[model samples]
Target: MTKELKESDPGSPSPNVLRIILALRKWGWGSFWSQLVLAIIASIILIATIPFVTRAAAPNPNVPIATAPSPGIGMGILFTVIGIGIVYFTAFWSFRYTKLAQKLRGANGGERPSKLQTVKLLKTGAIFSLIGMPVTLIGANAIVGALTIKSLTPQPTGGYVGVISVQPIDMFVVQASILTILAHFVSLFASLWLLNRVSDKPTN
Candidate 1:
C-alpha cells in the first residue's frame, strides 16, 4: 500500500517550512496573551499614576518657577519609562517565536533559521516598535506638559477669565495623548498577532 503524502511530510514540503509551522502553532497564542496581559496591566497602572502625578506637579502660584522636579513628576517619569520598557519587552518576547522556529528545526544541534525568515520576522516586530515609540514619547510629554502648566505665569487680562485655570488647549493635548498611547498599545498587539500569523505560513 502506498503511503499518503502530507503537507508536513518529508520531501513533500521544505523541512524548514514544516518546522516553522509546528513551532508557530505551538507557541503563538500563549506567548501572545501572556505578554499582552503584562502590557495591559502595566498600562493601567501607568494610567492610574497620572492623576497623582499631575496633582503633585501642579505648580504653586507663589513660586516664580519650578525649582526642581516634583516627587509626582519623578514618579510620572518613572512610570513612563516603565511603560516604554514594557513595550520593548513585549516586542522582544513576540520576536522569540522565531527562536522557537529555529529550535523546531533542531537548532539545538546547530541548525539556523533561513536568512529570509530571520529577516522577515526581525523586520515585522522592529517596524512596529519603531512606529509606536514616537507615539509613546509624545504621550509621555503631553502628560508632563499638562502637569507643569500650573507653573506658567498667568496671562494678565482686563476681563475675568474662566474660574477653571486649566486651559482647554492643555486638556485637548492630554486627551489626544491618551488616544495616542492607546493606539501604541493596540498597534503593538496587532504586530504580535501578525508575527504569529506570518511565521506560521509556508510562504516566504
Candidate 2:
C-alpha cells in the first residue's frame, strides 16, 4: 500500500508563488550568462564591421581631403558589451529571487519561508539590479555616441574635430535607455510581488 501524504496547514502560504520562484531561480542565471556572452561577441563583431562598412561606403573623390583620427571604436564596443551585461544581470537576479522563493516554499511543504530567508533573497536581487542601472545607462550612451559620430560627421578637413553631432539617433538611444531603466523597475516589482505572495497565508 502507498503511504498517504500529510496535508499542510490551511494557514500556510500558497504553493504557486513558490513554484514560480523556483523555476526562475533554476534557469535564470544560466540564461543571463549566455546572453552576456552573446552580447559581447555581437558587440565585437559590430565594432569590427564598422570600419569595413565605412570604407566600402566611402565616396570616391578625384580631389584629396585631409583626414583625422576618429574616436576609439573599441571603446564603443566595450560600452555596449558592458551595458548588455548589466541589463542581463538585473533580469537574471530578479528571476533568480522569484525562483528561490518558489523553491523554498515547495521544499518546505508548501509553507511560507522564514522572514530572514525572504529578506536575504530580496536584498541580494535588489542590490544587483540597482548596481546594474548606471552601468547600463553609461554603456548605452557610449554606443549611441560612437554610432552618432560615425553617421553625422564628415571626414575631417583639418585638425581634430571636437564634437561630432547626430541628433536623431541620439534621441533614440536616450529613449532606449529610459526603456531599459523601466524594465529593471518592472523586474524588481515582479520579484517583490512573488516574495510577498509566497510569504502571505493562503486565501482558502
Question: What is the C-alpha lDDT profile of model 1 across 85-194, one tens digit per residue?
Answer: 65646546564764656454543566555646654764565476666557467556746664665545354444643222444434433443454455345545555554
The residue pairs found clashing in candidate 2 are: 18-102, 21-98, 21-99, 22-99, 25-99
Model 2 over residues 96-130: C-alpha lDDT tens digits?
Answer: 55456455545555655666776676666666656
Question: In model 2, which range of ten residues has the least summed lDDT?
Answer: 1-10
Q: Report lDDT per candidate.
A: 0.50, 0.51
TM-score of 1: 0.38
